[model samples]
Target chain A: MEVVLMDILGAVVTFLVAFVVGMTYGGLSRKITARVQNRKGPPFYQNFIDAFKLGSKKSAIHHGVMHHFGPAFLMVSSVMTLMIVPVLTHNQWFPNLNFQGDLIFLLYVMTFGPLGMALGAGQTGNPNSAIGVTRGLSQMVGFEIPWVLALVALMIQYHTTSITGLMAAQAHSGTWLMFSSPFAFVAAVMAMFGMFRYSPFDIVGAPTELASGPISENGGKYLFVMMSSGSVFTFAKLTLYVDLFMGGADNLLILLIKTFALYLIPVLYGVTTPRYRTEQAVRWFWGWPSFFGLLAILQAVFF
Target chain B: MMNDKNSQKIVDIIQNWARKHSIWVLAYGTGCGAIEIPPTMTSRYDAERLGVRGAATPRQADVLLITGYLTVKTMKRVIRVYEQMQDPKYVIGFGSCTINGGMYYDSYNTIKVLDKYLPVDVYINGCMPRPEAVLSGFAQLQKRIAEGRANGAQQYKDNLEWYRANQKKIIPNWIMPDYNW
Candidate 1:
């Protein structure tokens, strides 16, 4: 009974930390983007207010049961991924559920929310939502090739499928995987661009063209749920990358700093670049990023 | 005194506060006055700093910005869009054209008074209100929302028959689906 209670408490703590941190970082990214564009941005807590306001709005029409419950489905997937990804390197405080999953599992789990979201968007009866979903699924296929290759290379090289084992190996070697296997890190970061769905690669939900894309029809509490889930998912994906490449962090502050540093790669890149057509984005991912993934594999095999 | 009614009032106060701070305007710009929106939203005026951002659809929007002169043909579409929006919504009748059709008052199609078909929560009266005027208009709307006086949506619901009658009187060929929402 006591063990079960402790586990529940730990899980709640992990979720709260991830939620608060994730949303704050999301707001900060908006602030950063605003500053880069020569505009004074909204406060870092603006997203919180937006979410709460959206939540308070009265519920309106829905297409069907699938559309009505889509946000709930997406949230479940998001929380599942967060539960699986370890936040800190080796800490009792962060008690992540990494013990239950490996890299392969995390790779597959990340897609669950998008699939659920796509279904919800499809049910909205909006043509733009359909177009957005198609672009997103296609982009996923394009980026996953190189991303999977990079992950497979690291797994083969480290001789462990588990994230904790990989981190333990890094601790023993006294070097981050980023420095040891520069090619894999390069490929992964490039993949992260597409994964982050920033500009250039942001053809999926092209806001200007598709009117906010998949979630175009989503609003009020539905949008609020989507925003909260998105923040949590963002933190999970970033933490996974940090754990996989930057050798993870020993403390909360270090974790945040390292994750934010890792986050800047996509964000700043997005700010300066123009949008890409879906096919162009797909081609871009399959071209240089795939080549780097191949090189990383060769390096792992030979060295 | 601290009963369910009191608690409901407290909830309304909190809800009103949240609604006032975060007003998502639908990106549907009606007519020539739409041109003024870009400056208000962009770096020059920066409306986002005040928690006013553009929403992609009516479902997500709290404020419907009727930029200017809504013609009889466009009024059908505007009414449809207005119906699609969720509750607690407000409409801003932009420019003198929306209030009394301005120079377009003599024109056959231009809607002379926008409030006849839909409630205008705030009206920024000018042929083309500058970005500063637009920003102040939004601030005024926010102030109204905070004071819990901006119940235009509720007003529309309460007098739905009258509003619908007025709307149908102008739109003789009303072929769009029922304004059920």
Candidate 2:
């Protein structure tokens, strides 16, 4: 009984911390995005207010009964992402979960909310949203491959699937994994940055091509929940990336600050660049990032 | 001195809070002019500083900041959204679309002037205004709201005929889809 209670308490605390941290990261990214564009930006509290208002708005039903599931699933997927991410601490039970897996687990698990959103949008039969959904998922397929190769190379160097272990090893070794495998790091960063879907790669719900993308049909509170979840998910993904690369998760504040730095890097990329077509993003990810990621793997092994 | 300072601080906070909440806008995004919205919300324009946001649903938005000219079809949706919005929402005609139909005035599917359809709180005169123009327009509208001079949505609800006639002209056989005309 006591063990069960402790486990429940840990899970609750973990979730609460991730929720607050994830929301903060999401909020700060919005501000960073404004700064990159030479704008003063919204208050950090804006996202929370938006989310609260969205969740409070009178529901506007769309199409069918199943349409209701999209926002619910999106919220669940976002919270689950915070739960799985070892961004806060490695002192998590089932840290290895199934196998003592590495970045591969992170990669696959991270895809769920997006995939679920895309599928849910397609099911609604809104041609615009369906097109956006199709494009977003297809873009994911292209980016994920090179991202996996980059992860594999890092795993080879560290020889463990544990993200926390990899960071600890790098911290003790006195040189960041980024220094040892700069090429892979750069390739992965670019690929993942594109995956962040800020600009250039914002083809899925290309406002020009298809209204507002998959959730374009969603309105009132429903759209709000999905968008807020997406923001939270974006922060979680960035947090995971920073924790893995920067070895900054030794303390919560350090982890947060490093994540902020990592988040800013991508937002800066977003502001300065123009959006890419879906085909353009896929080609760039598979073509250039893949090539660089491969070269880095060879260099890491043979050198 | 401390009591006076505390009271002053309380007053300042309340005023700030009120200013942030009541920014009503003209919700028209007439054409391709709507493309600038992402940058306005994103890190670039960062309208959050002004507490301005794009409300997907009409009821939650205080400002209906119209972007550009209105097509007949999009005009229908715009009217629907405007009707749904609560009172105290301000309408800022973004570009020439609301001022005089701009380029779309003589176009087959465009309305000649948006004011014929809805009350305008402020007219931002530009062919297609920049984010700066839009933001400034919002600031002007906010100033009016602060002084309690603007409450256009309620006025709109009371005088529906002027707007209805314009809408009826567009949708000649105007009846809810469920109702047989």
Candidate 3:
């Protein structure tokens, strides 16, 4: 019973941290993007206000049960992923649930929300929603190859699939995987560009085209939950990247600095580039990222 | 029991304050006033500082800006879009055209007055109001929201019959679900 209670506590803490920090980072990105375009952006707490405002809005209509469950499924996937990814290497402030899962399990868990979102959008009967889901899923297929290969290479290199174990390996080696397994780092970082889904790759929710994509039919509190889930999911993905490549940070400040730096990789790339058609984006990912993934694997095997 | 009600009131106050600040306008380019929106939303005027941004759909939009003259044909579509939006929504009648049809006053197809069809919380004047006027209109809407006076959605609900009657007269081949939600 005591162990179970601690697990629950850990999950709660992880979610809260992910939610707060994640939303702040999202607002900061908006601010940075605005500054790059010569505009004064909203406050760093703007997302918080938007979330609260959305939650407060009265009236929500649903097309079906799937529409109602869409955000719920997305939120669950986010919280579950957060629970399994270790926050700090070996500290006790907020231990993760990694003992129950591994890199392979996390790979499947992370995809759950998008699939659920697609299912929900499919049921909404909106053509735009359907198109967005199709584009998002195709893009998912494009990026997952290199991302999975990069992870497979690391699992082989470290001889363990556990995320905490990977972190420990980096700590013991006194170097980030980015420095040691540079190819995998390069491949993963390239894959991260797609994961962030900024411009060129932002076809899924291309507002000018699909009217905000799958969430076009969703509004009010439903949108509120989806937005919050997005913030949480963003944090979880960024943290996982940090733990895998950057030697996991020993402190909160270090974690913030590393994650924010990694976050900029996609943000800056999105700013300068125009959007890509879905097919073009899919082809681009398959061409270069897959090659880097193969090279990373070969390097690991030889060395 | 008293604390429960008090807490609910406090929560309402906070929600109202946030809603007042973060008004997501629906991105529908109805007329020439639509051109003025880009300046406000983008680099120069930077309406993001005021916590207002464009929402891609009526579902996500808090404010619907009727940018110019609405033709009889488009009025049906606008009504449908308005009904699709969730509660706690506002409408801003943009330009003299929306207020009194501007130069289009003589045009038979263009509606002379907008308020007959939808509840407009604010009306921005000028042939095409500048971005500053648009921003000021938004500021007034926010003030109305804070004071709990921006209940146009509720007003629509209460006066649905009158609105539908007016809407149907102008729109040939009218078909709309009854206003309840």
In the range B1-181, model 3's lDDT, one tens digit per residue, is: 6569888788768878999989999855777788999998999899999999999999988999889889988888888888888878999999999998899999999998999999989989998899999999999999998888888888988998898788888887877776556
- Estimate, for each residue in A1-303, the C-alpha lDDT of model 2 and write its tens digit: 977776677766655566666667666777876776677877777666556544544453456765777777777777666555675555643132223674666676777777777767877787888888888888988888778878888878777876767777877898777787887787788777667787778887566567667876575567667766776677567666775676646667787778777777767777688888778888888898889889878876777
lDDT of 1 by residue, B138-180 (tens): 9999999988999999899899999989998999987877655
lDDT of 1 by residue, A73-172 (tens): 7888888888877888666656766652468888877887888888988898899999999999999988898898898889889888888888888999
| Candidate 1 backbone clash number | 0
- Which scores higher on lDDT, 1 or 2? 1
Q: What is the model-wide C-alpha lDDT for candidate 1? A: 0.87
Quote the B-chain TM-score, candidate 3: 0.94
Distance from true position, residue A197, model 1, in Å?
Answer: 1.5
Assess the local accuracy of residue A155 in candidate 1 as a C-alpha lDDT between 0 and 100: 86
lDDT of 3 at A71: 86
TM agreement with the true structure for every prediction: 0.97, 0.74, 0.97
Q: Write candidate 3's Cα lDDT for A115-183 as tens digits.
A: 999999988999999999999999999899999989989988988889888888998999989899988
* Runs in model 2 lying further than 4 Å from the true structure: A90-99, A168-175, A299-303, B1-48, B53-63, B66-77, B80-166, B175-181
Q: Docking category for candidate 3?
A: high
